[model samples]
Target: MEASELRRAVEAGRATASELGLDVDDVVVVHDSDRVALHLVPCGVLARVAPLGHLAASEFEVEVARRLADGDAPVAELDPRVESRVHVRDAFAVSLWTYYEPVGSEIASTDYADALLRHHAALRQVDLDAPHFTDRVALALREVNDREHSPELPEPDRRLLSDTLGGLGAAVGTDRADDQLLHGEPHPGNLLNTRRGPLFVDLATCCRGPVEFDLAHAPDDVAQHYRGADHGLLHRCRALNWAMFSAWRWRRVDHMPDRDHWRVEGLNRVRAALDRCGPGRPEAGGAGTPVG
Candidate 1:
């Protein structure tokens, strides 16, 4: 996921698009971290060009987006210029999507909450055979447990990760009444403020969990407008989210943005969050778990 690797992935996406009969004059790197996202010129298409290892997740995203769009949900859509599926080229797996020309930079809290609730409402009713939140916990547990993935992780850090994942995983699992499809990680990064409104992208993180799980990823102020979301649950979920992402950052091959900084900052972040969730209320992070 370095710059050169990103260029290669973009090449794969460009080659794939050409093979698919789409016209592409140029390529813009929308973002490049764990994966390379591209904005194909003239085509008005956004391409998520990732390693072939992520093919399954890419496929899952396409299916989920199609279903959500069918339900009239506020989500980014698959590009009409190409087939609605994951396209492959060389070592990369590509999924083309409709690119919304960003209308504004900042998102109001009310607007953010409104879009999230609508997304949750549409996701709740969908009957997709997706993974539960425990699956994500299991993945994090395995990552920290396996030295191959996290060789330099200190023993104490490993223990912390396990404790957080175990406790929060159990907590999220204990209450199943509110379980439903969620955006998995609906942080601000995933939301696009377009003229049509805030449309969510990256359905690859979709999973079955409580609405609070999704709310945990949003800003604290946005939760106030969500009305019925369990505040306690959201707090626990936020801690869990930190742990989950912390484990990822610590992984040996994790190329997410600010890798060196986040690897340390993220684990410390989880430790601090865990202190807030202790004893009688000690907390909480999910999905057939994608090992991301």
Candidate 2:
């Protein structure tokens, strides 16, 4: 998350867009996280630029967008001006996406839920070569277990992440007969209340998991509206999500905004969720306790 790295990513986006015959002169940095999302002015294209190391993730997302669009799912479309694919330039990976003008700060919970439900229904038809949800947990688990990578992470918190990731991964990993392709994270951040309609973005997080696992990323109001979700499974997934987040916050290489604040908050959330865990799965009839 260095400025220089983002500069390179922006350069990559501009260079690739120029090659594609988009009169890209000025670019605006809309977001800076694992990737630098640049708004290519005049062309109205949102180029999500990241390091070359993220090529696999970007490529997978591009394919997801294309397939979802084919299925008529509510996803942010890839830039159709050029071929729908990831463009690499100057050792960076660039994917051009349709930049929707933000119509509001947020969308209604029901709208968000319905849009995600539509995506889930459409996702059932997609069979991309993506990893399972636990596969991602395994990645975070490695970060927690590697002391050299997270030397400052206290042993107790490390142990918490290790156990939660391992146990919940097993609990949710068993019996995938009903699992479907999920948006990885269908949270509000990924849900854009655009002038066109409700659309979801950031498809790289797509994974094979139960619907509750995807619902866990959403707000409680949203989860309440998502049809037929297993409350018990949602609880486990919420806790596991917090653990994975904690692992990332504690990673030495992660420098996301407000690291200290979120790290503490996420740890507290994990503890509260674990405290709510029962000897057996709670009767699956009621809404899960607010997890965030």
Instruction: Give the number of the best model, judged by TM-score.
Output: 2
State the lDDT of candidate 1 residue by residue for 78-115, as single tens digits: 99877899988888889998989998679888899999
Predictions in order: lDDT: 0.84, 0.84
Worst 10 residues of 1 by lDDT: 283-292
- Give every collision pair in model 2: none
Decoy 1 TM-score against native? 0.90
Q: How high is the lDDT of residue 250 in model 2?
A: 88
Alpha-carbon deviation at 188 in model 1, angstroms:
0.8
**Per-candidate TM vs. native?**
0.90, 0.93
